[model samples]
Structure formats: C-alpha cells, structure tokens
Target: MLTSILLRLVGWLGGGVFDTLIGRVADHLRQKASDDLVRFQTGVQADTQIALAQLNAQIEARKLQAQIMEADRGWWVTSFIRPLIVYPCVLHFSAIVLDSTFMFGWGIAKLPPPYDGYEQAIILSFFIARPFEKVARVFAAGRT
Candidate 1:
C-alpha cells in the first residue's frame, strides 16, 4: 500500500513539472514571434519613409529648375523661345485629342516616333532642366 501511494505521488509531481515546462516553451515562442513582427513593421515603415523622401527631393529639384529658368532670362528673343516651342506642341496635342475623341477621320499626321522623341526631349529640357541656350551678353555680363 505504501509503495502504491509513493508511485502515485511521483507520477503526479512529474506530470505537473512536464506541463510547466511545455507552458514556458509556448510563452517564449509567442513572445519571440511578437518581437519579430514588430521588427518587420518598423523596417517597412523605414523603407516607406526613404521612398517618400526621394520622391519629395525629385519634386523639389524640378521646381528649382523652373524657378532658376524664370530668374535667369529676360528680353524678347530670349523669352520668345519658350512659347515658340511650347505653343505649337500644345496645339498639335489638342488637335490630336479632338480628332481622336470626335472620330473626325481627318487623319492628322501624328508626329513620327523619332520626331516625337525629339519633341519630348525639347519640352522636358525647357520645362524641367536648364535652359539650352543663353545669350552671349548675359554670360559676358557675369550673371548666373
């Protein structure tokens, strides 16, 4: 009878100990998973912030390019160049849009691929990069 009681006591204590060890392992794993999730979220947020900063920098650069052009030039011939190129392109685009929308079938000749590429380069440079040409007098006058 004594042996039987001792065996029962040992089995009970061992079962309790086993249950405690399993619970501790489960808790540790849960905590580690939570920490990993938090780390991943933080990393993603940092990446997003970096991307946004780069985009903002590009926008500011374009704005500065336009501003610089506005400040750097004057006089009729110098000023006339921008509108000279821009107006015709604008009109051409409008005509294309109208023809396509109304199905006018005017068959307005679209700018061929090479010419279109050249046009894009010209427009982008005028609006988004430094002015292509500057007067000799402006440079001689020592003005930036």
Candidate 2:
C-alpha cells in the first residue's frame, strides 16, 4: 500500500514536469527549425556566389592564357595559382558554415529529457572534434 501510494505521487509529479518540459522542448525545436532554415538559405546563397566567382575566375584565367600565348610570353602562372588558392579557401569556408549548421541541429536534438545515449554522445563528440578534424583535413590536403 505504501509503495502504491508513493508510485501514484511520483506519477503525478512526473506527469506535470514532463508536460512542462515537452512544451518547452516543442518551442525550442520550432525556433531551431526556423533558424536552421535561415542558415540553410544563407549557405545556399553563399555557395551560389562562390560558384559564380569561380566561373568568372576560370574564364579570366582562360583569357590570360590566350593573351600569354598571343604575346609569346610562355608564363601565365598567376592565373593558375590564383584560382588554385581561392577556390579551395571558398570551399573550406562553406564547409565550415555547413558543419556549424549540423552542429546546431544536433544540439537541438540533444536538448530534451530522456536523452538518447548514442545521439547525445555522437553530437558531443562531433562538437568536440570538428575543429581538430578541420585542421587535420586542411593540413593533410597539403595546404597551409
């Protein structure tokens, strides 16, 4: 009888707290979704701009190459080197932004109670390791 009474009290308290938590979580998730949408749109716009710039650079490089050929200079290293440096930097910047988006998404997922063990651990690990991973990848790619 005592155990039954205790269980009933626990259930009552749990229900109220759980409902409150759920409401808050719902609001948080809605806000995060809205934010993610905005971030995604911004990322898309940035990516488009980067692509356009790369295309323009490629065209200019071709033009320079042609001019070099016409002038019999035999050296147009600037055109080749500029794009090689710029494109990767643009790509890496975009990647970092996208990764931040994912990190925010993961963070929202981990915020509610009754935590998912693997999801929590994975999100935490990703947040911790992302910077190191970026640095390692950059260095390994033979870029300074």
Candidate 3:
C-alpha cells in the first residue's frame, strides 16, 4: 500500500513544474492579448483563465505541500525503499516457481518504453534538485 502511494505520489509531484509553467503561460497569454488589443480583443477569456488558475494553483499547492515535500526529500529514501519492498516478495515467490527450471531464477521482467524512464526522471529529479535548492535556498531564506 505504501509502495502504491509512493508511486502515485511521485508521478503526481513530478507534474508540478508543468502545472506552474502552465499557470505562468496563462499569465503570459493574458498579458499578450491585452497588449495586442488593436484587434479590439477584450482579453477576457485569457484573463478569466489566468484568474481561475491563480486561485486553483494557490489552494491546491497549499493542500499538497506535504506530499510534495516527502516526494522531494531524497531519491534513495523513496526510490530504493520501493524496490526494497517489492524485490524481496517478488524473489521469494519466484524462487519457489523457478527453483528447478532452466529459466533465470532471479530477475524481474524488463520495463517497456516510457515506463522505463518513469523511475529515472521522477527519482533522479529529487536528487538533482536537492543540491541546487540547497544552494539557491539561501537567497530565498535571506541573510544577516
């Protein structure tokens, strides 16, 4: 159950940068429409989208902050914990079935296509971001 939750959380959290980008894009388009009003475009549609997204992002971001932090904490903490939980059970069960067979006695099947990169990007992003954030966070935190 925890594994399932972690997998889902990783996928969901990984999409956050896209969410923020979309919110910013909405802001940009709204600005452009207002600036390009020679066509008499009210920019109302874009403005409405931007307004709604700002509110939505703020509320949703606050509600999900904890899961986001946990997901971002560390690569090994989440990534390795998953396989550590899965591999043992998989091996124990497979061992019983494959012990006498000619088939390889201890292996999981290979992932297909995009699913292969799922763990790599989701987990690695935390690792990559952690150090960058530590350095940059000083600016955000302010100093004496």
TM-score of each: 0.43, 0.34, 0.26
Instruction: Spell out the clash pairs found in candidate 1.
Output: none
Q: Considering summed lDDT, which 10 consecutive residues are worst modelled in model 3?
A: 135-144
Query: What local lDDT does model 2 show for residue 103?
Result: 63
Give the alpha carbon lDDT tens digit for every residue of 1-144 in model 1: 999797578758888886677689999999999999999999999999999999997887666656655666666678888788877876777688899999999877779999888777776766666433434433443344
lDDT for each residue of candidate 3 in 71-142, tens digit (9 for 90 to 100): 555676676764665555455545645754657655545446685466445445545765687556444433
Model 3 alpha-carbon drift over 4 Å, by segment: 1-104
For all candidates, the clash counts are: 0, 0, 0
Superior by TM-score: candidate 1 or candidate 3? 1
Judging by TM-score, tell me the better candidate of 1 and 2: 1
Best by TM-score: 1
Q: Give me the displacement of residue 70 in model 2, in angstroms.
A: 2.9
RMSD of each: 11.9, 30.7, 30.4
How do the residues 86-115 of candidate 2 rate in per-residue lDDT, one tens digit apiece? Answer: 455445445556667776442222224443
Q: Give the TM-score of candidate 2.
A: 0.34
